[model samples]
Target: MNASRHLLPVLVLLLVTQWAAAQINDTLPAVVEPQVDNNRVKFTSQLRPLRGVAGAPAPFYTYFWEFGDGTYSFEKEPVHLYKDTGDYPVRLWATNNYDDGKKPPTRLKKIKVEKKTMLAANTPPAFFKGGGSLEMITNQMPRPGEDMVLLLGYRNKPGSHTATVSGSVMLLYNEKQFGQNSFDLAEARSYHQEKKIGLDSLLAYAPAEEWNMPLQGTLTGEADSRGGGLFTASGGGNLPIAGKPQLKAFLKEQMEGYRQHHIWRINEVKQGEEQFMFLSLNTLPEMIKDTNAVVTISGLFIPDDPSMDVERFALDLQIVASHDPNRIMLKNRRLNYRFTGKNRENIYKVQFQNTGKGPAKRVAITVTIPGMLNTGTVELVDMKPACTWCDSAYANQSCIDTILTKDSIQFIFKNIYLPGTQQEGISDPDSTMGYVRYKLRFTKKMKKMPFTSRASIVFDKNEPIYTNRSVGRFKKGLSPGIIIGYNTIPGKKPQDILPQNYVLGFTLSEYAAYKKYFQWEIYLEKSRSYESYDGRRIGGDTMINGVGYKVEYRDQYRQQKVLSLEAVPVHFRYNINSYMAAGAGALVGVDVERSVTPVVETWIQRPNGQGLALMKGAYEKQLESFANWRGAFFADFQLGIVRAGPAAGIRFLQYINPSHQRIFLYASWKL
Candidate 1:
């Protein structure tokens, strides 16, 4: 029986280990199944069945296929026709939505086209017609410990009608505001003869008057309808144009906001011609764990021509647990608790894609509005498949209409044509996607708690496809507090010779947490006491064999000073309201320094028998010690503002070994 008891736990652990290994093996990467005919190839994927997540939509797979010839598609089984006969490498990313398992792994395959059967007449159109002079887009959202590709598209549009230009492009990542790096640049691929350069070399190309203000305004002040700015509250901000502050000034400003950056020097770019650069960024394993959080990667485009104005662009991507095309996001998911209040504006974006095999004439999106937000303040900031607002004058043209309920908002795209990803003759994946962005303000006196919202997308009369929940959380800010207290031992009267104890300390805890939080504290305490004792006289006025009687006496006085380093290692607190709170925790302390001074006097009677007393000995001594350990348990109550600012409280502490207790009256201010 004893042997079996000892072996049972080990057997159970082994079983668990095997089960976990089996679970991991069940989620292998998808296999690429390709069929080829001359230059035309049809690709299919065989993916492991998804393990569905509880309470989530039905499990499904989303595909992102990259053809070797600088082209890609979002179709499940894309059929491509190669114009040139060469070896092409193809890759696929199979995203399992509503699945409990990790995303399926992918393998790159090299497809060789030896014979050409058809003409290359249906070439895709060129980019940079509408995506501004400098723009960026990512293949997919970032997943921790995974890799993602960012494509930077730039054009030579130096307004002076210059035929050719040479300039540099910079990619900035890993915002310094976050404590840990979110991404590391693994590789950068450039087809053009772009050379990597240092920061100083890039700054050397700046124009004169570097400190002048930009023609474009600040990115943090308002939401940009163009969706190309450092998004703070809303989804967009002004994409700045360095009209006056030259290229060097902009680079200096960007350096302060980002932790790491990479610059590339372009030798030449012809007018109206566009160039592309692809960066492979590996999401660091220690990236921030907020799955719904958003991280930004900014870019700058500078022309060597002194007259050309520099341009800036930014792209925001959410850190996702899984890649899902239909999703909603708050651009600024983590907010400062101090500034989040009424009149604070926030932007919410809903994105939907058509996955069916045909186009939809109408699409409707309904979103749940968190109670703390004021729905009356909703304003459309931007949208794709851009259309005008519905009016009486727009019955025939395509337009968007809004309907508001008490707790939800619905946006209907009417008389519109949105192509499906699997639709025939569709080559551009971007053409099948749509999004709606709107801004809202917080209600007055909202609670400082996290909020979430999701969207339900409908294509014509089909079932609603639910998106992921977008959460808005306040950054767990730090609150530093100062404590001053005076403590007295319990069961001690005014005249009972009590030690004088005074405490001065500091505390650290979550800043104004909604209800409950833990705190850690350390303090210095000084305790002083005085002690004295006297022995009664003995052998007084006694004589033996004609000798005087001898008497011995002793008296002593001592003063002690104890300086202790006190700490609270485990403290749990709960705030009942804005002004009242309670807490309980264990406190530990050690006397770092201690000192004691003693005065002793001894008296002896003379032998004359006449009782003549004289002092025989007198001495003063000092005693010292280090590291006297002690511990106590304390429960405290507070009055006044418990979250921030000033507060006063009293704590009761009971010592474990000595069976002594103390009461402390303290005042604190949390800042």
Candidate 2:
């Protein structure tokens, strides 16, 4: 038994080493193959064989194609139609999932279209479908120091007008809420005659036209609003505002919230025609390194013709450390500790992709839920590969079946055909990707600490793939407390001490911390003390004449007032339970104002006690400013809601200089 115990740790270490080694990816390359039929082209990619992960799903490659004409596609083989014949450089980025190797490097191919053979009839006109005018999308989630592409799609409403129009488009990123810039615009490729302009220029390019539109409406309706003559003039003309200040005000309002802005002026966009603009953004090294954190980029389209409505779109992406197909993210990764309780809701999203050569008939995603979150409060917020919830009516149809366990939730995609990344004739990589977002409320009683959850994805009958841990942490919220205390020296008589010390102060600490944390205290103290002694007779003082001298007596009275500023700069505290806590630290204080009042009187009496004389007020009061400095070490214990809110404590302080001790009783309330 002893030998087995000694070898157990060694065996566990070896297993961990082997598992880590299996996760290292190899460097593979993908080559792009394009077939050109004059202005039309059919694009394909030749990929190297993917190294399969042991006991894992079959390895495959997911492709992102940029056709260099401000147009792109996620399909395995996409057919693109060029408006004009030219030499365009096409780029391919392929990611290998379920493979024991690095992502394949990007490949670039230049295709020259010298002849015109295919007409506009070969192109699909539903690029911006379902009445959507502006759309923003990204090729991949951002990884620090990696490059990603963002495509902005804009189109005029199909039946709005038949004439050409000019517009300005703005791309806003690097939200000021984050500490550093997440992405840098490396390059922009616009096939159309789109000219980059400054914010001032974009705002200044106002055309002389306007259309009446009501401002009082829902936010969603305003975003998708088509121009209408809501308010008419005397001659049935639409009410018009000079220079469209409302639109400009809207644009300026958005600009203030972001740190980086890129604006482009697009010219001569015909109605019912879709336009594209591609931007290559490089994730900076200083980007937020939290893998579960999310960032957003917004795109705005404003046509010069005020008759057309404006459009705005936002694209949100998660920051990643690797090109992993299966991952989990927490939308509220950082929460305010003070405001977190049973009523707070946290949203988590789990995304998975089938990277096999064949389609997956059944996909199951098992997520481990943190204990702080209430499992009963799980509600599905959104999902991809959209389907109805599984029930008796949908028993044999495509649906998502959910099973709740004590500590986990399993979402099973049943009776569905989800395409694989390497499946033949599958062009869109998005077809292989699926995700589920669910919101969970916190438990009634929970600790102010970070929690993490992860997902295990299984495709068909293959091995499970584990994703990164999605972490949710509480922000170190501050707790400001009002402190009132009384100080006294023990083992002192009333006449010897006359202790009347009072202290008023405040404390600062982490709000509702479950574990050990530090706190700071500052205090202002005022103490008034009085001491007096009756006259005492001593041996007769020598008289000036060398004869019998009269008896001499003296009377003394003293009073002191001290105002001090005390600070406890270093104090460590730990909660023993919900109501009890212990702490110990040192403090230094200075008596900013000190005043002393001394009164002495002398009397002379005859030796026979026949005569007596009195002297009063011989010595007056003396005051000093900024006189004394003191330091002490202290330990304290608190009771009654020690973690937060109201608490009362008793402290013992040992003064270093003069070697004295004081007892302090205090009450505090954390706000």
Q: Give the TM-score of each candidate.
A: 0.80, 0.79
Off by over 4 Å in 1: 1-122, 129-131, 158-160, 204-252, 257-259, 284-286, 391-393, 491-502, 526-529, 534-552, 603-620
Most accurate candidate by lDDT = 1
Which regions of candidate 2 deviate over 4 angstroms? 1-60, 75-85, 96-113, 118-130, 159-165, 206-245, 305-308, 492-499, 527-561, 595-627
lDDT of 1: 0.75
Model 1 lDDT tens row, 1-671? 99999999999999999788768756677788889888889999888777777665567676767677766555677888887899987878776666777777767788888998755643443444333467776667888987766767787754647888787888889999888999999878676788999977876765553332224422432222212222422112234444444444557886787999889998768886777776777888799898878888888777766555566666777888876777888977888887777888888888877877899888999999889888888998878778888774356688899999867899998888999767888766667778888898888857778888989999999989898898888888999999998788777665764345667999999998889999999998756565555444454454447775555655565656666788999999999999999999999878777766665554656555556455533355555555668899999999999998899999999988566898988999999
Give the total clashing residue pairs for model 1.
2
Q: Show the lowest summed lDDT stretch of 10 residues, model 2.
A: 223-232
Each model's lDDT comes to: 0.75, 0.74
Would you list the clashing residue pairs of candidate 2?
25-101, 25-102, 26-101, 26-102, 75-427, 75-428, 76-427
Deviation in Å, model 2, residue 381 alpha carbon: 3.0
